[model samples]
Target: MKVISDLEIAQTLHLPNECEELQLLMMKYECAMTEMITKLEVLSSEMSLKFQRNPFESIRCRLKSPQSIYDKLCSHGYEVSYQSIRDNLNDIAGVRVVCSFIDDIYLLASTLKMQDDLLVIQEKDYIIQPKNNGYRSLHLIVMVPIFLMKEKEYMKVEVQFRTIAMDFWASLDHQLKYKRADIADADAISEEMKISAELVSQLDNHMLQIRERIDAGEK
Candidate 1:
């Protein structure tokens, strides 16, 4: 069994007042994530009706648990406080949109950016330049407005856009890398995954081209 590290221990030692503050801040992030998901659902519906196809296949969301947040802050050499968490981490709340095709990833991301309420803070195109471990996705850090009972607040949420193939590769890669420790040729496996990512990229592009041609009524 893995033992808890010192960072985890420190994060668990937050004061009572700090805990209350952190709870409220986490609630705000949760609300922000919900609003973003709802916005995407609305967009998905509208796009499906207008274009006769949905761009995204599924939407997945996650909010970092309090313990995870605290551990992250401690790992970054910061005190376990709400201020530190807000300043240090951008992925406390995250949403992932899985699409059927490569073009859908970019199209959905562009559509989300066009919304007046969502303020795009940062964008990273990992699909174009995949990570060494075969990771491929587009990441966006956006600020979304959440209207409370008496106040409107904006909170940051990290959004990721990925194709079905990309998500499949990522899921397997994550499991293989983290779930196993007895693999002998880890480096070789990493290299193979990179090559597989290239193949997946080619497949995505080919399918996208075929889709475009079909939409254009071409044989």
Candidate 2:
């Protein structure tokens, strides 16, 4: 058995906890989140092999707690409380998966949801029901079990599946919007962003059609 040193764990967490109870709690959460990410990565790789699809271009998993949540709340002039973070984490146990095409995004999401051990807490088919901002992807909140030496705990994992094209546009939009928030041409840039979003949507549909044709020929 490989043992992770306490020092290594401490380095990863970065936050100092005065109470032993809090330290243990933080360690447990970190370990559980890391294990969940590893499981997801394995699933992603297996899926790529099974479908002969390109490996996921990128996948990210994150775990946030009440303190971190409270900081954000305070920054936004909201109540600074532990419960707020807990509530937010309950809603956003996130994983972002980037794929080669729109169809692959759906197919990968479906494959992951089919795993018997993974319990789907909720699902939002954003690709089919995109937000008004033109965000396109599948979002699923799932519960995965983590086994410790003598116990098992359930952890929430959020999965967001998207295509490379969608990611590219989103990345650019995020950078420009945030980096140039005070620019005089921001309104003009926003309009162009909306147009680009629509183009990505059209491209997604066209790619999906091509994939359907390929599947039909395989049948």
Candidate 3:
């Protein structure tokens, strides 16, 4: 992958065309995101070949939008420069893994942390300690080495592991946050969503228990 240096971008582009200039830098993040996605897909393939099972149900990758990155840097009071983004933001590239059961989330997270190539820089086990909003997921910030044309660069990519039920609740919760004008009672709906998150969590544990029993019987 060709790396566009800040000097090259600045010299070729005008000052007003900041977004276009930033978009050129996205190639680094794109490469970094693809590297993480490939690792996840390879893990899924190997698991299916060996155990006829996958630790995750699905894998999703995303790169932060140029506008979003600029906004985030301003929000954090950081310098709005390419080097500032690389130095401060750890979630420029993200990979989300949705699992079938709660245990599968852990199984996949532990497996990922064990990889020698990827270094687990930070971990947040929301399953063990649910957030105030009752959100549950295993979040890991991993540092992956992206081998560029001339030099290798270490980039941080956030990996989120969640169960199907957790994802279902989170998706609806996010949509509601955006469609607030359509709701009759915003506070009431927020409360109900929190309750729904709790219910889905309980459901996840029950399903995990049943899965464990089935596996035990098979063994």
Name the candidate that leads on lDDT: 1
> lDDT scores for all predictions?
0.84, 0.67, 0.80
Least accurate stretch of 10 residues (summed lDDT) in model 1? 1-10
User: What would the TM-scores of all predictions be?
Assistant: 0.89, 0.73, 0.85
Query: How do the residues 1-219 of candidate 3 rate in per-residue lDDT, one tens digit apiece?
Result: 445444544554322445454655577677877888888888788877876677788888887755577678888998877668778988888889998988777767788789888899999998889887778888999988898689888778899999999999888878778787567897787777889888999999999899889888988
Off by over 4 Å in 3: 1-24, 181-184
- Sequence-dependent TM-score of model 3: 0.85
- Per-residue CA lDDT of model 1 for 111-214, tens digit only, reads 88998888999999998787767789999999999998999988999999999998998888887887445678877877988999889898889989989989
Steric collisions counted per model: 0, 2, 0
lDDT of 2: 0.67
Candidate 2 all-Cα RMSD: 4.9
Q: Candidate order by TM-score, highest to lowest?
A: 1, 3, 2
Residue 76, model 1: Cα distance from true site in angstroms: 2.3
Please identify which of the two predictions, 1 or 3, would achieve the higher lDDT against the true structure. 1
The C-alpha RMSD in Å for every predicted model, in order, reads 4.6, 4.9, 3.9
Task: Write the residue-wise lDDT of candidate 2 on 1-219 in tens digits.
Answer: 123344533443332332344344445555655665686688777876887766478877665543454456666665433234334454334568887777677667777678787788889887788776666778888777777789987766677788888888888877777866888997777877878888998987888799879978997
